[model samples]
Target chain A: MTATVSYVPAPDAAPRSRMLGAQTRMELRLLLRNGEQVGLTLVVPLLLEVFLNLPLLSSLGGSRRIDFVVPSVLALAVMSSAFTGLAIGTGFERKYGVLKRLGATALPRSVLLLGKTLAVLLLEVLQVGLVCTLGLALGWHPHGNPIWTALLIVLGTLAFGGLGLLIAGTLRAEVTLAAANLIWLVLLFAGGIAIALDSYPAPFADVARYLPSAALSDGLHHVLQNGGGLPLGAALTLLVWSAVALPAATRWFSWE
Target chain B: MPPQATHAILAPSRPDEAASGPALEISGLIKSYAGRRVVDGLTLTLARGEIVALLGPNGAGKTTTIEISEGFRRPDAGTVRVLGLDPLRDAAALKPQIGVMLQDGVGAYTGAKARELLDLFAAYAAHPHDTAELLELVGLSDVAGTQVKRLSGGQRQRLSLALALVGRPALVFLDEPTAGMDPQARRGTWGLISQLRADGVSVVLTTHLLDEAEQLADTIVVINHGRVVATGSPAELVRAGAEGQIRFRAPAGLRLTSLSDALHAGASASEEAPGRYLITGERSPQLLASVAAWCAAQGVFAEDLAVERRTLEDVFLEMTGAELSA
Candidate 1:
């Protein structure tokens, strides 16, 4: 028997804002409440600042350690919230079939990813603000344009979050979880610190400038420490990373 | 009054049939995992408000098949239409009208309260059920404030069910929804399912428990080795059994020669155990009575005398050549 078909398009359907906004808000709440997320985004940066301020490191830096540490730490905060958070969370969600459940919903996949990105951006803004407040309390002041700094943060998060999803979506959950967290730690220490990338020497320092953490840190520092305008070169590098990583991540993401 | 009744009375029913087409239809569904076909050449149709149970053994392709239907995975080869839209082609459009509950939903949200998670999901649709009403519907109001991590297994499953229903979906897919529930919890879920059906919501579920399928399914489709072996009403399938089983004990020294000759006329017997024998293929009442009369005449006493209707378990084992996991 032939099945009859008819089409009725809903032209007056409400805009997709409600669902997108709610998904982002819920993601933010879940991230904040998670202990590891809290530690990674909040406590880790604050502790890193304190550790960088040690007197033994004072000889290695002419500038106040807090001045140098704050910007790099902000980048760290963004990475944690964007890259590590997305990777670990998405990996677990995939492992536990959360994404598969969502896949079956009527919510668009693009909207889902967009909501998550927005949530991560919201988290980075809050983290940057909080860390900046603490830096001001410590008498550390940024000399660069705030607008340029904000742009870097947003673009940097997109790039990192895209890479995070790419890793989490393609690899086994355990492997993704382990590799993401480990990369976070390695980048934290080995990549350019409050110390200059050039000061480290040889292959390590040369490769450091290419690392995303290093790119973001270098960009933020040029703007924040030197009172400079947005660094177009660094922005372009991160943009290229974002352009490639975003598509790769979305293409590879698995619901299960 | 029950929660479902309140909603049913308040809501106006949609037209019985959509002007568009079948609520869901799939043809030539096929999927494989690591080169092994899990769901091969499966076709299914579900109308609005129909609850169909996809019954099968472990790894029998039920989950794979449903995942494809739900648009979680792309089919290797198939045409799937959900609510007149292809799930793969129009996933975004179809998702709002359907809900999915997977078998495992552990450790996703860390400290989010149950109600918070529900509200979060509910927000994903233009029309969302009231958070309180949804919680109440799933019997989760008392634990609204509880973090998901702290919820018991049954409570978590209930929360998952609530998540699936919160969108007020026209179609829902539940994978082994009652795996860890106690009897009370299982019945509660069944009650919820019945309520969903009454409200004109269609559900497709995969489960190994025959009783669940028998209780909740309007139609049951059984799959074995990635192929649909049988599909029918529980009663019709049971009625097709070739024969019934009869059990009796022979009198000491009565000897198998006489019993075999007596039952060979219309039945067959085998020593299923040392002292007990099972006579199968006994179609005539006279043969059953003759066996009983022979036992009596031989002064043999038989215990555990009981006859049972054929069950889904019997049909499943017979057709699939495999046992359903408890």
Candidate 2:
């Protein structure tokens, strides 16, 4: 308000790092403000944690139901934040020309990708804390290194987030809208987030373990339910999936 | 609010800061989709502080040419320079130096507040325009906190203009910048653009409105079939097609042969109706005076005498051909 003038910057006046930081901050605000996104990313996971832990659904996870249901719910949280929420938001952004607008700015394309990824990761943390608070109240106990569980969370995020971008970037917004939700539902039971891989038949369990969702669910289960040593299988599967999907997303993403 | 005490950025602080150079230069630009050329061998240039209006029928490739210059699309064949650098090759370097306003409400973040979005864009520039004042300048202050999705079409157009100017660009590209604005807002926007030129920001805008181009542009480029049909000032282009017209009412049976003899070269007069006459010739006060003199000598009164000059619309329709685009 002091000394009024139109305040456009000369070329090279602002540093690139600040632009990326601002983008990340704006992306975070948008993600948090959307009511549907908030419900899916945080509320759904907490509801699922409480429901699956109820004595009525006890048979789904066996004697130590709290430990089992909590991990699965955490995995679902990761899936929701990284996959469904991010995909729908980005798909609509592309459809609405938000991406094209950003593409025209001085902000780098790589920075835009990093900025959105960071925002999702940041939201996933809030999701984890809220769900864990509810999990603890429901008598859920974590047995392993919280560190190992954290690794699975990050890896799970990349794998799912990568695929989200791939779909949102390549497909039509309506198609991406339908496909993201469908994929999330399909993976919830079959890929081991809700149905533990070990509960399935032997060959099917083997195949599920190869899924990023399964690897995340099982990895978090191993680390949090069994005192953690190392989640090697989960890490490797997630690493491979992340390596492929992230690059493919980068290759296929369109601005408009 | 009407910005009763608003200090505008319309006056760029460093009006003399811009050096003498072509803000944009394009030659032999070509673009095609599915083997159909959208922009074919198009050439155009914009100099510092100048406004070039690219007028065309739909599908004339004006948008395509602008996109290529903005680095949004790659030209299949051509050379383009923005501030003397390849727009495509040096996009990162060129981006901060140019501002672009896309057509049809393309770039708004519907969920974010209008002010918040502008602030975020301001962060991208080393010296962005004052965020709040920009909203005020564009008449968006009342809706600063409102979500983009809730904005009216005219408000969105104003916001788009604000976003385009936030980067303090040396050159700006606007695709139908004032399309949805009300008459007052359009006048305000034209005032802003006029000041943008005074601040030494070169501009290239595409529009279907010939009057807008005629009033605001220093040079008007008429394009058709993916190529430049004619390029000149609005006055020059209008004059190129036909001379001004003169109309009056007199006796129905006045012999035009003597009138033709009294007129200058290439001038013709015809009776459009019972008592109405039209004359097409070189437009001058003398021509109108001569018509009056002839009327007086013939002992007839010239009623409803009016002189009308050719307008940009005439030139546009003449060059582009009058046909409805699908």
True contacts kept of each: 0.30, 0.53
Put down candidate 2 lDDT per residue, A105-207, tens digits, no spaces. Answer: 8888888888998899899889888988888888887788888888889999999999999999999999998999999999998999888777789999888
Q: Cα-based RMSD of the predictions, in order?
A: 5.5, 4.0
lDDT of 2 by residue, B103-170 (tens): 87738689999999999888988767778888888899999999999999999999999888887887
**Candidate 2: stretches off by over 4 Å:** A1-9, B1-20, B250-255, B272-276, B293-301, B323-326
User: TM-scores, in order shown?
Assistant: 0.86, 0.92
List interface RMSDs for the candidates, in order.
Answer: 10.2, 5.3
Model 2 error, position B60 (Å):
2.1
Give residue A227's error in model 1 in angstroms: 1.8
CAPRI category for model 2: acceptable
> Which predicted model would earn the best lDDT?
2
Top candidate on DockQ is 2
- lDDT of all the models against the reference? 0.77, 0.85
Q: Highest TM-score among the candidates is held by which one?
A: 2
Going through the candidates in order, state the TM-score of chain A alone for each one.
0.91, 0.94
The candidate 1 chain A region of ten consecutive residues with least summed lDDT is A1-10
